[model samples]
Target: MDEPVLEVRDLVKHYPVRNGLLRRSTGAVKAVDGVSLTLDRGKTLGLVGESGSGKSTLARVLVGIEKPTSGQVLVDGEDVTRLSQAGRKQLRRDVQMVFQDPYTSLNPRMSVGEIVGEPFAIHGITPAGGRRAAVGELLELVGLDPDHANRYPHQFSGGQRQRVGIARALALRPKILVCDEPVSALDVSVQGQVINLLEDLQEELGLSYLFVAHDLGVVRHIAHDVAVMYLGRIVEQGREAEVYDGAQHPYTQALLSAVPVPDPSVRLVAPSLVEPVETGVSTSSTSGGVGGGAIVLEGDPPSPVDPPSGCPFHTRCWLAPALPEAQPDPIPSYPPTDRPDAGLRLVPAVCETDLPALVPRPEVGSAAAPGDVPAAGPGAASHVVACHFARGLAAPRVEV
Candidate 1:
């Protein structure tokens, strides 16, 4: 953690919205607004969000494919955002991208060898031994046969073509790889293999990854840290467990609710995006948001172009301030916990009124999740969340 391999600060990407016969600009699409994160050297930071949440745009900006409207990208503590063309070339080569959609990413007419070795051709980099040998080494490193490099992209399966893409990304011996939903398109079985390959490579070569995907389950397994993006901004980010298990924001809770649970017997009461929380249910859905526990978020996410004032999630947040102070308490806790182990009671007003800052805190201890995000409170010792109720700062804790 001394010097992060990549640090993206307050990044923003806005696209003008065109309309009418003249095709004039009417508005702008807030793809990414004020996203800041640090990718540690030799670690994976998973970027998970719903589609159109700007995960890909951030990835593109990291690799120099898309310039940010504002903010900076620092590589090795040096600003790459203001670098010239030649400097960008050096930065781009050091940080490669494995694009989404293998079918389209690789040219159908080109042979695997040509696509993988194209970097050498473009950058005028001829390996010591030969270009052919370097390409072969790249293919083998990704678990593909070197001889098959002569075959066209169409001849290989979706997974194989993806491996080719990986080979291409590794062609330049990059220090970091920006993968945009690399496994979403492949079969379920193939997805595991590719994920394993990434892990193995990370261990063997000490590569850093900025992995973008919508699957929280996959993200949980591979990522050391997680950033939860909503609309165009990062609603919550911290250590993987801190954001998921110790979520202080309603949006983060809603996202965790959507991840299907392997078991169905457990039922949880979810929060309503547009309605205030009812009086009896426990606030913290202790059982991980599913089964006997659920935290359903009511209503849809609002448009990003014109986000609500105060809190962007206020419009659909179930923790709305509309409910009277004396309203009936159907669910006392967000994920009402009946067991003694359940930790931290959530404060509704603070969550709905002000946006929750992404602060690392010691996670609430539990059997299923060990040392993950604590249900609440800030600690001087380890990563912990400091919600109003947990830290005795904002909303006072109430008995369920």
Candidate 2:
């Protein structure tokens, strides 16, 4: 495989919420805690999760929009973590971002041309003739008329404005585009058009993408690989098909089951995103389809500041540790010293008491050697899960 365009190793981003004038380091909200992913050159990675799952924060960190509290961010095999302000800015041209709200992302006052060409201006980039011809070409490339370059963002439709945003992102001829919920603000019909534009642009330019969205459908269509995030951590990740078709995590299973079926005859029997159809185009609860339905993890997304001690999800998890006397098969204390795989537990004792490591299940009789845990198959090597009993999860259910 070609070297990855972006590799995030145990990336953690926690925003400290301060109170009082002195600001004595109040607690930190774990926006993105321990996220590790590899995005190959020219390939797309869809990071999907609920509203507060730190998806947006992670994107900000990827492009240097926000700094990560810990972990390393490697772009093209070089660590960008320690780069100075100027260094970060230089890297920004290579890795650009398209924000979620087109209305808000674009400066309403600026003409489309200026908006699209801002990158060039910022980087002291002189496109032979001060960015005019280049801006026109960018507009045309995004499927909008070059003439519209003079218009303000307000003059265009939601979809059209989004096209302008895309044009702006492409001005620097970036190799990687970080899309943060790019289509959630558009009409459902328009979402497809924007998604198609991105696909076309990707193929034409060999661009890599870190597509951040809440929509499963959009992610399914555009992402080469996908990661399912919860709270601040990635619960499951693998090749798109492996994770989408055969989701091994209960959260994943619940998520996939929720996408509403368009067919009226196909009643949503179990708890999926769709319920009985109403006359109006029935849409699910969340802004996008994939973001909807699956039993919402209980409790508001735990405050990133001072997250729960045990497994972050355990506080809301139905399958959680209960009092030993009341518990059935008490949550198994993990990484016992007797087990060779023990040191994996670095969490506070609360998590250590009975925490789940997203380990992979070995094929029956496929253990590396006696007492050696089974090695994950090629496809599922990254398929490693974080849940304690993750290895014992039922084989993912395949729809097709």
Candidate 3:
């Protein structure tokens, strides 16, 4: 493929935690820690994760709304982080954002036309004919009547207001759109309309999208590729069919199992097929050993201020330990030890000490070879994951 339209390398955004009196910096919330991905031209990359998982922060960094604590944001092979003020402004013209909330994102005091035309004014580009005509064209482009351009935000419905937001983002004629949960606030029916509109716009304009949302169903429908984020990092990413159909990471599997199945008759077999590893301790404290085909995570997500050691999700992971007794087949245990009890007690010591790299599992084999795992290079074989146990889970239990 040609060079990606957008590329992120080890992006990190950390917010300082402040305390009383002097208001000195205490610690930092690692909102986005070491995230990387690539978006090809004219394609949508759906970013899905639970709330507080840094999806929005990542989006903000991508569009230059938030500065990264470290790492690079490259647009068409140019490192945006190194760009000057004038150069940055030029970069903004190529990338625009659609915020999550339509009501708050649009200025209620301003007319729809003013809001939509603001970008053109900021860039000092008088439209081909005039501002009004250009704004009217943008309004019509998003399916809103051009006459409604004079109306205030309060006068329009939620869906219509969002359409106005879309119009504004397009005023800059950006090649890449960072849609931060654009359809989440609208009615479910309205969401379908907006998604279809986005699809049409991408086709007509040859635009790329970094669509961030928690809605898996929406992502599945619109995304050509999918990246699953957990604890401020990408756990798994690949083609939509490959990642969804054959998720390797335990976190990915757990997330997929949580997606609601509409049919009552269809049943999942993951929970029943795998035997629970007995630690000889009570499982009641931690969600009863993963119930009903769902890996019920115990406790709230770890605090970003002080995230867990090693694998961030290991604290609540049901498959943290590699006890052969845990499943029908013996899986690989970490620490490179033979004695299962030495490593499989409660928390596997290797998971607590060593961080796993995002490695590509063997294409036709079950085990990942031992070596330095490379980043997802510019190729079709970019199905990379960040877990030691992922190789054992090369095949997913259900069609996510």
Candidate 4:
């Protein structure tokens, strides 16, 4: 199999929480914790999750904008995490990022030409026909008029400004693009145009993309592979078809259930393991069979600085109650005296005690016999999920 253009192994990025006049290190915001994935050459990997799932943080770490606390980020088999200053400069050329907001990403003071040509100046590379000509070509390549190179970012529409950002990212002919929700800020109509432009650029430049977004619909349109993240961990990952057609994790199912379905006749239902608790906040229950209503997850995500002891997602997981019983293991930090008075709820004890490993599932069309696990590697069709009860819970695929 051909090598992956980018590979992240157990990547972790944390922000230390400081307090007191002395500014002592207290806890860390566990952003992008133990994230592992591979982005194959010329393919797009859609990283989807809710806000604060650490998607953007992971992207920043990948593109060298932020340093990771631990783990490896390999570019063409070479670990770039601990490179020298000069090596890091080369790493920047190899991997560039398209920021989320077009309005703020570009320098309002600089013209489009200057913004696009800045990479050449930083790298000290002179294009064949000078920087101006090269910038003009990039502007045209992203569907903007070549003459618009002289225009500032403020003069362009939201979509056009994003195009300028893309042009700047492509200025150095980078091998990989870490697009951190690049189209989320644009109008709905213009979003498609930007997505199409990205598709065209990827095919033309042979660029591999790590497209991060909260919108599953956009990801479904462009991604060849899908990785569903929850609370800084990938709960499920597989090929586009495997993930969209046969998602096993409860979080993935809930996320897919939330995708807007245009048809009025079709309904979306997310079955819960226990009776819906009355928390004032609206929640959704199973509407008879599995077919449309959003699975309104109860409670906000736990604080990253003080994440749950076992599975970070176990608190809100709907499938936890269905699993078999195990010994209870309470969190050491939150003793009975310190626990919240939300009352008690029934869930599998193991769900709060053991963190399940993201293991490959049994192959499609085959019975999951004991010890029958698929091997995960490049080009392998292994559907990996990090749920203890994933083997018994075969979630119905929801087409967006």
Candidate 5:
């Protein structure tokens, strides 16, 4: 198999919280906590989560915008985080970023040409056909008219500004692009156009993308692989089909179930399907955590400054030691010998004591037959999940 374009291992980033007049550090907000994943060359890895789930922080860490607390960010086998100044400059050429807000990301003062060609100037490399020609080429490549390269950023629409951002990122001909919600601010109709544009650019240039976004629908469209993040860690990851269809993690399942179905008739027929999680599961029978219905997550996520001891999700986890009836049958248990923490299998005790590692589960029936499915290797058929009970309660494949 080809080498992965980007690989992150045990990536962690923390910001200190200060106090009083002296501003002494009191606590640290755990942003990107112990994240690890691999992005194969020319593939897109969609990092999805709600706000504060550390999606943006992870993207920043990958592109070298923010230094990691501790971890390895290997770009094509090179540890970029530890690279020296000159090596880091060269690294910038190999990797570029596209931010969420095109309006703010682009400079209002610079013409589209200047914005796109700034990379060449910064790297001290003259464009093949001078700066103007090179800038024009980039503009056209991102689906904008080369003639419009002389226009200011304010002259373009939201989608057009995003196209400019893409043009700028491509100017350096970077092998990897870390896109932080690049289309989040665009109009719904325009979002598809930009997404298609990105897909086209990837195929044409053989670019690998670390696309971060909150929308699963967008991720589903762009990502070849998907990694579901909770708090500050990846709870589930696998090929797009496997993760989206047979979502094992309760969080992943909840996220998928909440996606708005377009069929009006289906919504009318199964109105209960669209209702909040608490509405379905009786509160009396289900005491703690969000109930059985649709996995509606309750309460704000735990403070990152002082996250819950074992599982960060335990406080709001629907599967946590909740109602007696809602308790998972037979209880979920891992071998006492393998992990550092073992034999701690009370409803929330095990989850609270041991931070579950992302591990593969058995594939669902039919969509992938037992013998037909490939073994969990670097290639495919690897649907890694984190929650202890997710395996036994794996949701069936539901095509979007």
Candidate 6:
């Protein structure tokens, strides 16, 4: 097997919080905590999560827009986190990013040609028919009219502007594209065109993509593998079929359950295991889909500045009650007040004390029989879940 073109090993990105007039360091926002994944050449890895789950932060780190707090980002076999100035510039040539918002990503002042050709100027490389011809070729490649190369960004539609962004990203002919919700800002119809364009480009160019988005439907359509992220950590990951068909993690199950189904007659039922809670926070499309019965979590995700101990998702996990008995004792109430019920309800002691590792579950996969654990294949070992009771949890029925 060919080596993965991109690999992330326990990547961690954090932002420090400051307090007082002296600007004392108070705490840190634990965004992109201990993330690990591999993107094989010419394959798309779709990253799905909620709004503040640090999806964008991980994308930025991969494309060199933000430095990681710790951990390794390996491009090919080389570690990019510790690259020198010149090495960093070369890294830019190897990895590129497509920003989410088309309106803000491109400079309105510059013509489309200048925007796309800017990479050549920065890298100091003149193309074979000169920069003008090369820019025109790139514009054509992304389905934009070369004649419009002289036109400014404001003259184009949102989708057209995004094509311009893609053309720009391809200017350096980078090996990997870190697309951060590239279609989120476009209309539904235009989004399909853009996604199809990306697919065609990947087949034609042998490009590897790290596709990040909130829409599970889009991910299901475009991604070969899917990784479910929550509160900066990947709770579950597997091949698209394995994940969509046999999700074990409670978080993954909830996300899959919320994906909108097209059949109007098929009534959506809330998963039997999940007991919906009314936490003032709206139970909207947390995963960016509409029309299905959502597994509405209790309360909003905890603040990254002070993430809960043990499992990060334990606070929101609906399966905690069904797990084994809490070891030691349940967590004490906050403020350490005299009353035992002074703060939040007690969770399973184990869930509140020990973090779960992402480990393989041979029993869970696309090919496994209902209630039967399949023998672990080379690919099946990659189907991993971070929940402690992953093996005990039954595969979630998504389309009921």
Q: What are the per-residue Cα lDDT tens digits for candidate 6 across 144-255?
A: 9999998999999999999999999999999999999999999999999999999999999999999999988899889999999999999889888878876777777667
Clashes of 2: 8
Q: For every model in order, what is the number of clashing pairs?
A: 48, 8, 0, 4, 0, 0
Model 2, position 118, has a per-residue lDDT of 90
Locate the minimum summed-lDDT window of 10 residues in model 1: 391-400
Residue lDDT tens for model 1, 1-400: 3347999887888888899999999888888887878789999999988787889988888898888889888988889989999999998789999988989999898999999999999898999889999999999999999999889999999999999999999988899999999999999899999999999999998899999998888998899888878777776667776555555555666666666665543322132322234532233444333343455555566677776554566556555444554653322433444533354444445534444444444323433321233343334322333233333211111111
Candidate 6: pairs in clash: none
Question: Taking the tens digit of each residue's C-alpha lDDT, what string does model 2 give over 1-400?
Answer: 5568999988999877778998877788889989888899989999988788899999999999888899999998889988998899889888999999998888988999999989898999889665899998899999999988899999999999999989999988888999999999999999999999999999999999999988787898899898889888888787887677656555665566555567532221222211222221223353222334334443466777766665666555433433343334433433234434332321112333433344554342242321244544455565655554334322423343
- Cα lDDT over the full model 5: 0.76
Whole-model alpha-carbon lDDT for candidate 6? 0.79
Q: For model 1, what is the C-alpha lDDT against the true structure?
A: 0.72
Q: What are the Cα lDDT values of the candidates?
A: 0.72, 0.72, 0.77, 0.79, 0.76, 0.79
- Residues 148-174 of candidate 3: C-alpha lDDT, one tens digit per residue: 888999999999999999999999899
Residue 29 C-alpha lDDT in model 5: 94
| Cand. 2 Cα-lDDT | 0.72
Deviation in Å, model 2, residue 373 alpha carbon? 4.4
Q: Residue 369's C-alpha lDDT in candidate 6? A: 25
Please identify model 5 stretches exceeding 4 Å from their true place. Answer: 264-294, 323-347, 363-381
Taking every candidate in turn, the Cα RMSD to the unseen true structure, in Å, is: 6.4, 7.7, 5.5, 7.2, 6.8, 8.0
Q: Which stretches of candidate 2 lie over 4 Å from their true place?
A: 128-130, 263-297, 325-361, 364-380, 393-396
Tens digit per residue, CA lDDT, model 4, 21-117 = 9999998999988999989999999999999999999999999989999999999999999899999999999999999999899999999889999
- Residue 10 in candidate 3 has what lDDT? 91
- Which stretches in model 4 have alpha-carbon errors above 4 Å? 264-289, 322-347, 364-381, 396-400
Task: Compose the digit string of candidate 5's lDDT tens values, residues 129-214.
Answer: 79899888888888899998889999999999999999999988999999999999999999999999999999999999999998
Q: How many times do residue backbones clash in model 1?
A: 48
